[model samples]
Target: MYLEKIDAPQDLRGLTTEQLRALADEIREALLRKLSAHGGHIGPNLGMVEATIALHRVFDSPKDKIIYDVSHQSYVHKMLTGRREAFLDPADYDEVSGYTNPQESEHDHFTIGHTSTSVSLACGLAKARDLRGGSENVIAVIGDGSLSGGEAYEGLSNAGEAGTNLIVVVNDNEMSIAENHGGLYANLRELRESDGKAPCNFFRALGLDYLYVKEGNDIEALTAAFRQVKDTPRPVVVHIRTLKGKGYAPAERQKERFHWGMPFDLATGEPKAAGGGEDYCDLTGRFLLERMRTQPELVAITSGTPAVMGFTPERRREAGRQLVDVGIAEEHAVALASGIAKAGGRPVYGVYSTFIQRCYDQLSQDLCINGNPAVIAVFMGTAAGMNDATHLGFFDIPLLANIPNLVYLAPTCAEEYFAMLDWAIRQREHPVAVRVPGAAVVHRPGPFDTEYGELNRYRVERRGREVAILALGSFHALGEETADRLKTEAGIDATLVNPRYITGLDEELLEELLRDHRAVVTLEDGSLDGGFGEKIARRYGPTPMRVLNYGLRKEFADRYDLGELLRANRLTGEQIAEDVLRIVR
Candidate 1:
């Protein structure tokens, strides 16, 4: 009732402290109900309920700009900002995104999904306000391990010397995507223990004023702290120590599991559909563990998400020092792996395809230029991966493959993936990146080549004439479907080729295809622009051969249905076959 009555931040201003406490409870209940049925970031939002309520209660939101870093924790902020229906009503569950979006509401300034960007974004807002001679306060709510990012430091350093009105609320949940790592966490721990009284302050050192609120979960404490710095002239960092998953017992017990979860049982806190089947993540973890047994100097590195590599807490424990978590610092992870490989130690950096985009310079200058044999296992590098605009996985091919001296391998199945990984770790020639098949866990029964010293050799699966289907990575299944359609519907036996390497083209195979093939169709589960398909298209540009590149367009698609997205891009088997028939017949 309290939550329903309040539609905006201004409404919360009227509520008494006791009434505000009741609203917080109402918000939590709504969050749990929605999160239980329609799963999203549970722990982060749960932890931020009071802080969000306090923020709304203290600040005039749209007038005074507030930006949330990696806005996964912005659910409660949404609730008070006229978007509560999305959380309270099941019918509207799909209405809002998991992160903050400016399109959704005026209160949500930035459409931030990535971590550690809020401080820099807020600094920009502050600078603009000063330029226009506006008096609105600029607040950057950054924490939940965002401080570990290099950009966060850069923003804080800039904010320090800017001598402008800026408030950075450090929501210290003492966890990143996983447990916090790096030397900065040690300083944070000291600050928390000392209750902001510690002489050695990271914020103060960067020329920013510092304040600490030990009881971050307490609405009154948070409100008081926010009010104190409401109109502060100089930039300041208000470090608040809060529990990650405060309200729910299950989340409190298993913080990481509930940080972001699938639809789960509300009572038992168990997932509705238990994970039983084999996934690419688990397969990668098992294979690496087995290999690490024989190889003493072998190391596995993750920026923040170890689970992406299938390294659970148990698996990470078994690996011990061998498994290193750099803590939300992808740039450092790439450089660190390069250093390890340069020192004659085998380093495998397992990262999500989206996260790896943050380290392109490192991939090019530090790893590829140095030619260190660092094996990077790229997860979710397909059209079917995370559909968020900020976390698009399909773009990695263009980002990584174009870099010189980097062997970007597109594994067709599980067998090929492991083979590539093994070869990448063992070989000391070039920096190799393995794009782990993002679709179903496909098992192809055959011995994949372990030594890939000889690059750009495309394997022909089914030889035929007129049309050559150069299926790269996960799109191999679609290629097979198109070939089947060509044979059944059009009475044509199309050639099916598996292009294992994405970085370079097999000129011999392309030349051979030109002799008989009238049209070459390249099927890749990535962007069409500057991707694997473009290289093939360019190869046959001057010749009589017609090259049709099929993949997602160079645009950000958010929370898209895989089936719908495929159909829109003309990626279906029937569509491809029909196009091929037109070109060939």
Candidate 2:
């Protein structure tokens, strides 16, 4: 096979157009085979196969730097760059991560997993090359609806103004996770319809030379286009129109569902494993839809990732104008939600913990400072979330909790989560963020308080002397386990407390614990540094109370095993109980 004989981009240099086409076919087959068994980004990788081939054929990677924005489509690039074995062999399927990593190979310039960064990153690389008197082609391949991001524009504007040797390849698939949103996408559609000869081009408007290839999947056309701008002294954009989920029929039909997929059947393209019974995604969607029916002014906002908030395409249609998706722009989403709230409209911005990092300034300056009651539903804010270093969910605690005037709440179960959500939407006080349970959809049968006017009040689940176990949010289950372990193994009845709020401490409850509790153990499912546990430790810094903070350390864990990571951090009930025994003894 052409793929077997070819190892690197240099190998592709000698292959005939016919052979390259054959190789593209083989690469698609390999991608399908691996993606069918091992879940990863499906639509993006499938769409970029030909474009990636044309790229490797035209330029010298590691020398001529090619940066993929978000790098979700870098699987095809990886297969061509001496890592095809990982795709071909099932045993080696787990060898590479879903996103590009510089550690994996010299060919991969950056370890990127987020959106709208390629153009800016490539701009920096191009600037450095010009300064060093090095003449290597610096290419930024950005698409899959990444153009909507504000940074992409910033990068484009910078590159255009620099007039240096930088090539920005816009891979227009006309989709961004969900159907594209924003005015920039309309311009992209115009360019696609007019074959890049549109009078008002987004790229050209930014002062960059532009070329468009309607046949983005055709290797010959793509190669010729790349060759035209290959050592250009000025910045230019090669806008290629490619079909998302190009080869696979099922993927082509359901673009968003196949954007990132689970292990699926190769023939039918159906998921191999059925989804577990209940999940927070669906629950959040259902609840919000019901709420939207009653509240006309209620609006649900998402930063490109609508599914994270359980607003699927059908559900989105149901919600209609009430639901807004600001494509790949978290910063805008935060500010928009703030604006909506400021206008007396109830705005709930549903976002992933990782993505929320982009809106820190907006959360602080735009939302929190003004103290608009914008409900920010934070998904995957736990150690059990996306394990990739670039997409870790454990860091949001430090990022969100420390921000003044922002009240961050952590609910132990679905009942409490919705109750908090309802309250946040209704309340017109401080900016509220609810860290939705990251683990399984934990359902507890009980009445939860809908009103939360009084802040920093921790709920006591169990009263005991000697040892106090303060579990926050997702770690409440672990707190229960520790209490049971303390009872049976250590014969010590430990106090179990659920600290509902992450931003502020329950001073009253904490002060009362000093009377009977010898050691206060704080368990949080996030980084220990500047997290909920650290706040508790700081609260007892001056007092005689001994506070033990249990959580992940301050470090990036890349694609790590959840079990090993938890054990390493001593986050287990067994580990916490043992530590408590030492403190008591």
Estimate, for each residue in 1-585, the C-alpha lDDT of model 1 and write its tens digit: 899987889999888999989988999999999999999999999999999999888889899998999999999999999998999889999999999988899898888888889999999999999999999999999877899999999999999999889999999999987799889999999999998898999999999999999999999999999999999999999999899988899999899899999999999999999778999988889988888888889999998899988899999999998999988899999999999999999999999888888999999999999999999999999888788888889889999989999999998999888888888888889899999997579888787888898999988999998888999999889999999999999888899999999999899889988888899999989989999989988888899999999999999899999899999999999999888888777
Cα lDDT tens digits for candidate 2, 1-585: 989977888999999999999999999999999999998999999999999999999999879999999999999999989899999999999889988898899999889999999999999999999899999999999998899999999999999999989999999999999889999988988989998888988888888999999999999999999999999999999999999999999999999999999899999999999876788988999999999999999999988889988998889999999999988899999899999999999999989998999888999999999999899999999999899989999899999999999999999999999999999988999899999987588987777888887999888888898899888898889999999999999788888998899999898888998898889999988888989888888889998999899999999899899999999999888998898888788
Name model 1 segments beyond 4 Å from true.
none
- Report clash pairs, candidate 1: none
* TM-score of every candidate: 0.99, 0.99
Q: State residue 68's C-alpha deviation in candidate 2, in Å.
A: 0.1
Name the lDDT value of residue 13 in candidate 2. Answer: 92
Model 1 poorest ten-residue lDDT run: 438-447
